[model samples]
Target chain A: MALTNHPSETPNLSFLKEKALQLRRLMLVQAAGKGQGYLGQGLGLAEFLATLYHYELRYDRDNPEWEDRDRFFLSTGHYSIALWAVLADIGYVSKESLPTYGADESPLEMSTIEGRVPGVEMTGGSLGHGLGIAVGAALGYRLSKRDARVFVEVSDGELQEGSTWEAATAANAFGLDNLVAFVDCNGIQADGAMVVPIEPVADKWRAFGWDVIEIDGNALDQVVGAMHWARMARGRPKVVVMRTKPGKGIARLEAREKAHFIRVGADEWDVIAKELEAENA
Target chain B: MLKGRTLGMGELERIEDRPFRTAPFAAGTLAAATRCDRLAVLTADLGKYTDVHPFRDAHPDRFFNVGMAEQALVSVAAGLAKTGWTAYCTTYGAFATRRAHDFLAIACAHGGAAVKMFAGNPGLTTGYGGTHQAIEDLALMRAIPDVTVIDPCDATEMQQIAEQAIDIPGTVYCRLLRGNVPVVLDPATYRFEVGKATRFGEGGDVGFVSTGFMTERCLDAARKLETQGVRASVLHVGTIKPFDAAAVAEFAGSVTRLVTAENHVLVGGLTSLVLDAMQEAQILRPMLKIGIPDRFIECGSVPYLQDKYGLTAARVHERVAAWLDRSGTSAAA
Candidate 1:
């Protein structure tokens, strides 16, 4: 909730780096307890979420429904664990709601946006639905001539949903400059590799009429630069293809294929905790 | 008292200047409407078909055309509502109910997102054949909880209710029958509350309860019943879900026989709503249902199917007469 020289001054890269590390740690804790969560996605997307929450997104932790605030929608609902960690780290949610991650009664379900977490928007777990919602919000802001922007985060695999393309085409056709789409190209899904071959992802976005930008998602500078370019690009919607590893923070998990859902034994968890401590150190 | 309005083609042209042709828009006319400037409109290439074109023209920035994708149409509308914008998504009933029902149920209703969905040509109002006609929309839409389903009798009612949908803070699935329907209810004399019933006629021996476009036909049926010494009452049920069970049950219990009709599949629509209300009120009355049987209606002119499905006034008369004759009931008591 602290404002220092309007989001770009001094660019607190160190603080953002610390936040990303904290997000990975929280995600690891939730994954350790449940034996699963979208830990790989949360870990992979930690840097992007950290940069957006810290420097880009204009949100109020106290009032999530503040009318003129910027809007962010997670098109890929399965990645809520990563989102939850970033939200908690930013004081958007109570620390007590953290451990009840996948519990039945908890509003912090595995993948749902119940407005409980400040700045969390839209209840989305279904693929292909979030883009349309984001487009709608962006359209709303433009209509009201509000400075609020809309950011939608999607996965590489989720591009298969027809609704995503439908909404993408619409956003471009409408020339919605206030909308930004972040495609997390982590190269793995429930089945296997994305597209079965190397895809010209940025070119594809450009062809679809979007102002496309690509970056190393794990790198905080590139992520921030791409976001800045997105904000600067006018008269067209923008998309950032963030190339990232499935699990970035933990080495053993990053090397494994099924790291999509990790289950480390108690001894292995102690190793994860030690690695997290080393990262902090 | 909805009485004596011109019917047939040239309906939209006739009422273009007449204010309050759509309910959601009419709700905007009154100053007492909700200040939720989150009021945005989304249409799937149906800006004119669903009669939201006026709103689009008036508030260009607040209007969106999502092209022909009905599924994305509702999904996006739900998303906008989640972000504190009161969004109204419009499309044809066939597409809105059949193509986008899952999104309507999950993204909009189950998600607890306050969005309004308006569809044109619910039932047989569309003369454009089977594809455009929403014979099963009520059947599909009524099953979702927290979804307020409405089928305005005519353009006047549509205008009035459309305005209310904007101010209302919940999800509403309303049928939009374009152009001139037989304007049977007056906007002044008869109140158009979302969950209330409108009494169209009064009689004793039989009652004709209907919703949507059939309310007018039921009035004609009541007129014919009068000449035959069979005094029939008519209850116009505009709101299908969160149905007016008390009025329906009270009428069904009081009348000798109750007949329900609509231009839809005989399941999950007006008849089903009335039947459920009967059960809830524990009124075991003999009821005859008049509607499209369980089958995919073949594409044709609206008149062709109306004759085939016995949705005409003459058929209603004959069916009611037959039921009354079989029971040997009279209103003399």
Candidate 2:
């Protein structure tokens, strides 16, 4: 199947990987500005966010509210740092607004608030809510006969919420083939590691009757390929189990303990950015 | 079992065929759906119970049953609204408020989605016990910022409110009463406004402030008290959240005594609202609250529950009469 609305005519893995590095650099700067934020999850899903926003998703940066644009819902709202980075790179938001994130009176809040930002579809600080709302929007699109699809990014830690399963069941029951869910399994939550262990997560979605695809989320090719496969699938909802490292690019941040909410000192942020730039070079 | 009373299989069939107060909701929604294609009817497996089966049947493509998941029901409705569709969903009041309150608050209210949530079996209207009843729903919904809280009194009011709620932008939580509802107010003259209370009768002795189905009971009590030489004015408050405090204060200023009645707990419902309004306006007078006290009511038949909680017209009349006798407030000529 042809990759619809891809930024490049041919599959350019190098360019896409560069885009991911750019997003990571932007996220690092945003987090460092706030002194603390959801840096780990944002860095981990950089490739997936870059692949979806730049390559796979069909969105008009000039007019974010265009009627027939594909919707991307960030279920793990703490990952607003990643979303704001992607939105700025795509011109949906100003590059200067990145530093004001998580500050008072700034629309670019720590968590995503719908309508406050251009690309944000819904407010998602509360876990287990995004997939259900995505299901509703998918159903709405099907009823309206709009050829737009909805891509929702959820966390593996969010699987603990009962409402997530409830939404999964309804998505399959309604046969929402237009809806695709990306479960970012970084394996780290607010209270340290997964206390109870929500392993075998792929089987859970498959049991709920979704077209499941597991992939290494940090790999640019696998993230883009899985999205294409999900868009081509029919007769059921789709889920891409994105198993990724908590900190993807930088070696120092990846090895650091307690990667959930990373608070690097002002000098350490410069080292992290230089490490990312050298690796890309 | 009782003398000359139908029981067993016959009683079951009779109750099943009994007309519910929620019929207007189904009929009104179906009527509204015909005109607006953007209208979608959704329920959390409460199609038959909430009387939304007709809309589901008519607009099968637009109808969605999200199983018994109230959280998904609310979140999905918010999602549908975000896509520029006016979505309406219904479920038991207990489930809507207690189970999926966060979703309703975040997805629908805070997001400012045009989702209308019609919650049924408010207060003592259900006989399935305390778990099935939602007594504190008004208090819970009223506390949410920017959510329009409505409690329709009867079938006509329910129909009018259900049709108009779709046009009222933002999230709305409307209390619904189903099964064998009474028609109390005259549809010809009664105008349903969002935050305005309508005065039913005039009197200078006392003001009978009421909301929801209890407004019907208060109207009856006012008529009965007229024969006893007590001129009691009736003010029916339908919208509870953006409450018409001015109308309430004007009505209270004209009367010597004030009595607040409701089909809910007296602590945080209409009585509390009227008391706050009176305090804000500094219009203090002799007041008596007649409704469920500060306690959890036991399960029983609707009539038994109504009488036990002093929710009936006769009970309201009795309470007002006793208070008048004690205060010696003379009747208005």
Which number leads on lDDT? 2
Candidate 2 lDDT by residue in tens digits, B118-176: 99888877666778778888999999999999998887788888778878879999987
lDDT per residue as tens, model 1, B60-145: 76778888998778887887776567888878889898888878887788766778887876666545666777788887888898
Which 10 successive residues of model 2 chain B have the least lDDT summed? Answer: B6-15
lDDT of 1 by residue, A1-281 (tens): 53422257456889889888988888877777666677888899989988888888887766666777788888787788887787778677666677778877777778866555666686777787888888878876776678889998988888877778888888898898999999999998877666465378888888889999899999998987887788774799999999999878777778887766656675677787777668668
lDDT of 2 at A66: 80
Clash statistics: count for each candidate = 18, 4
Q: Candidate 1: deviation at residue B256, Å?
A: 1.7
- CA deviation > 4 Å runs, candidate 1: A1-6, A195-198, A279-281, B1-38, B82-84, B111-114, B127-130, B330-333
